[model samples]
Target: MRIFLGWTLFPVWSGWAVTGPKEVTAKQGSPLAVSCSYKPGYELYPKYWCRPGFLRFCFTYIAQTNGSEVTVTQGRVSIRDNHTSRSFMVTFSGVTTEDADWYSCGVKRRLWFNPQHSMEVMVSPGKAGARRWWRQWQRQHSRVCLCLCRLPGRGERSHHRAGIPGGVSLGELHVPARR
Candidate 1:
């Protein structure tokens, strides 16, 4: 299993406040769950999951409901909003490479959609060959430390550090390849 953990900070001007990991990494054909916590003011607002469209502001909504809990089997996605907890969760079952994409957790308003948080879901092939290649690569570059940052609006940027103690090395990271 491969896991990618990072923080995705959102600017306060986004309207709604949400907190969750910046990215999620999972193996193909695996089950994965991600949760987003929202501000108390959005408790009664409908929550939704959506995929990014070609246009910057366009979104393809997967499923949404005003209820506290809703599930969609056709999409193999399930969502739950806990009013008492002030948070919502989305779960994906039997995820495939095709399922990898940028998704947003949003709150529906009267006239607009407020995206609280966004994430890039990456599904790895999970083949043994890939794992072996990663291991070999790590052994060859043991002294370098790499940090990947996902900047909003801008694309991803990586920073490399050398001879830093207690920093992440090559083998400790896993980035899924595009299919």
Candidate 2:
């Protein structure tokens, strides 16, 4: 579930200063929040959030950061802030293997600079049944489109980065069959 909470910064790229949940856990289809606060000097750019995995170059711009607030318009992605905390909430209706990835939230104000306030979202199946269901569904359904299996195997998957980190790369080895 990719949601746009508006623009926190823009074109300006820096690094993450502080972030939240440290380590968050949730069951399939549950709500998730990946939040962070940039250095006082900079803010997050309200860019449209994108899907977890894809085969080609893709990106969506949502809005702009007015001052400290961002407005995002994507599925279930939302931004909430208080004096002490700011974060992005990612909600999924039916969690699948496709929903797993290490999400990064940051801002890029310009091309010359790097993004700031980067955070990682580690999404995993809450239970073995959830994972098994996802695999069964995929094995019986996938038609060879774009895959996000950075470490492809009989069942394991990976995320495809859009035009970043050279897109996506898979490992040489695969995992043993899960029984």
Candidate 3:
């Protein structure tokens, strides 16, 4: 049961102060991890790894760290903050297809504007090799690629960074379905 919301818990981009990999891939039954770094002054803000729904609303928080360097864990999800390195890490014990989605590494801010790093989490099922449709329009039946884009708001041009990230038109990660 997936929930869809209209509003976002955090906007896609505000200042681009945080940095992280645009995508993270993992195999089923294996662990996955991603790290995000922030500017020095933001060490006191809470850092989170969450799945965002349509309209960028954060639907679930897999893991989130306190405003300090302590580590937080919830079931299979874990998050660690390193204030000295100005970085935080989010990890999952056993990844499944349900974990694949558009996620963000963000800092909770006082104002509405929060610094967020967007990333796509891809979990490949029981297969050693995977194929993806890139830069072309190939119809996929099982699944479709979900990309995150921030539409231009007021004062921002309609063409400003409003397309797919990394400029890659990824269709889907496909593997042979079991009989």
Candidate 4:
């Protein structure tokens, strides 16, 4: 005898989803990109934004179907459509670490299955030391010693006597107490 599964017995459809941004970076202010993808034919109809298992923020209109843009939070949050590839480009400028969370992109189609995509947006504050060192390093190799100090802060003063890479010399750290 053959047994059948409930879901398999009925018509089933397949939808596509994305999890991460194609490219991401953490700047002085936190910014995030919510990614989404589809399998075509499932036109990004009536696309809706949500907080995942929570509430729906906005829904796209037919006029905005092919392309649309929405601004939120005093223009801090915005969504741009990439009709060429059927992807939504959502951006959050001046974002903070607390902005990290799961966002949902819901799509409606003829199929009752109703497609949905989600991505976690993580915004991290720029690494202070790393950024400072990187900026100094870009100026000139002679400033590398200063870059090192930025990384280790006051502790690096002692290591300054250890010499820097590229055979560059650094001044010694002299403490009157040690003398």
Candidate 5:
């Protein structure tokens, strides 16, 4: 399994932050879940999951937790917010190519919205060849793609910059492949 960490720092906003994977790759027809964490101050605010619209600052809400623990489902998409955890989770069941797009997890504010965290969800064809290519690439460039040298008990202390091929940075966190 492949794991991607989306970590970004927004200089424009203070006291507000969103954390999640910067990008997620899911196979078409499979279920995908993306977890987003927000600042504790916004725990009581309504949490929302939305697709970014073409217009700047416009978002189309797919579903929201509406300040409750109940899971809200809209079609194949579902969103649940856990105030205790200061986070929310969005899940898509039977994802399709049409589902591939940019999504945001945000807190609804009185005057504005704090959709600080956004992620690109890519729905791939799930072809065997593509999987093979990814595995081969990971194996051949294991040092660059992912730094296994830092693993516990590896006895190596090299700090490899964490990033993926598309120039997306995963910050300082080392994401290990799922066995």
Candidate 6:
């Protein structure tokens, strides 16, 4: 049987657990990914991601990998399981303010406790929010490296390296993380 007391859902069975980052941040209109990992023995079990609203009433399958390494995509979201890593990843193609929600990742087991964990996704506004986030991150971390490179046999060689208060653009992380 399944039990849903409130926001959290607990199943009556084994006591297996899954772990992952409890919170993730993303900028609107950019891509975001959340990963949940399970123990070794559950590697072959199907993995799924969904919003809690589905667990108690709908019993729906948002995005699931039928115990396979292949990725599953539903609309703008996709779920991929990596057996070797014993983890599953869910990605959102274009994040919006409405996309910010509490999501769950689970390893599905028949007649057994399905290990699951909740993740909170926070989406910031547009470019302004991204710049604000970058500035805040810069304040928290003391070290950010900036590097410039040129071809091996080029004309005059120029090298530049910067530490903490270095200069980085929206393209710093190389991922549209700031876009």
Among all candidates shown, the one with the greatest lDDT: 6
Instruction: Name the lDDT value of residue 165 in candidate 3.
Output: 35
Write candidate 3's Cα lDDT for 1-179 as tens digits: 12333233224335368889989999977999999999878999989887776656455667877798888999999899899999999989988888888888888877755677888999886453233333233332223334333333534322222233332446433333222
What are the RMSDs of all candidates, in order? 19.5, 18.4, 21.3, 11.0, 18.5, 14.5
Which residue runs of candidate 3 sit more than 4 Å off their true CA positions? 1-15, 127-179
lDDT winner between 1 and 3, please give it: 3
**Candidate 2: tens digits of C-alpha lDDT, residues 49-117:** 233234211244222233355444355455433323444443334555455544444443555343433
Q: Residue 31 of candidate 3: its Cα lDDT?
A: 97
- Candidate 4's displacement at residue 38, Å, is 1.8
* Candidate 3: residue 13 Cα off by (Å): 6.0
Candidate 5 Cα errors over 4 Å, as ranges: 1-11, 14-16, 54-56, 127-179
Per-model lDDT = 0.69, 0.43, 0.72, 0.49, 0.72, 0.74
The numbered model that scores best in TM-score is 3
How do the residues 100-179 of candidate 4 rate in per-residue lDDT, one tens digit apiece? 66666656555554556555665555787468777677556532332223232334333332323343454543222221
Better of 1 and 2 by TM-score: 1
Residue pairs that clash (backbone atoms under 3 angstroms), model 3? none
Q: Candidates 2 and 4: which is better by lDDT?
A: 4
Q: Against the true structure, candidate 4 has what lDDT?
A: 0.49
Query: Residue-pair clashes per candidate, as listed?
Result: 0, 37, 0, 0, 2, 0
Report residue 9 deviation for candidate 5 (angstroms): 12
Better of 1 and 4 by TM-score: 1
Cα displacement (Å) at residue 35, model 5: 0.3
Q: What would the TM-scores of all predictions be?
A: 0.59, 0.42, 0.61, 0.46, 0.61, 0.60
Residue 178 CA error for candidate 2 (Å)?
Answer: 36
1-179: candidate 1 lDDT, tens digit per residue: 12222112323445357677789998887898988888777788788787856533436667676754555443688888888887888888988889888888877767554656778999986676478778777666455545565545667565544443223543354443332
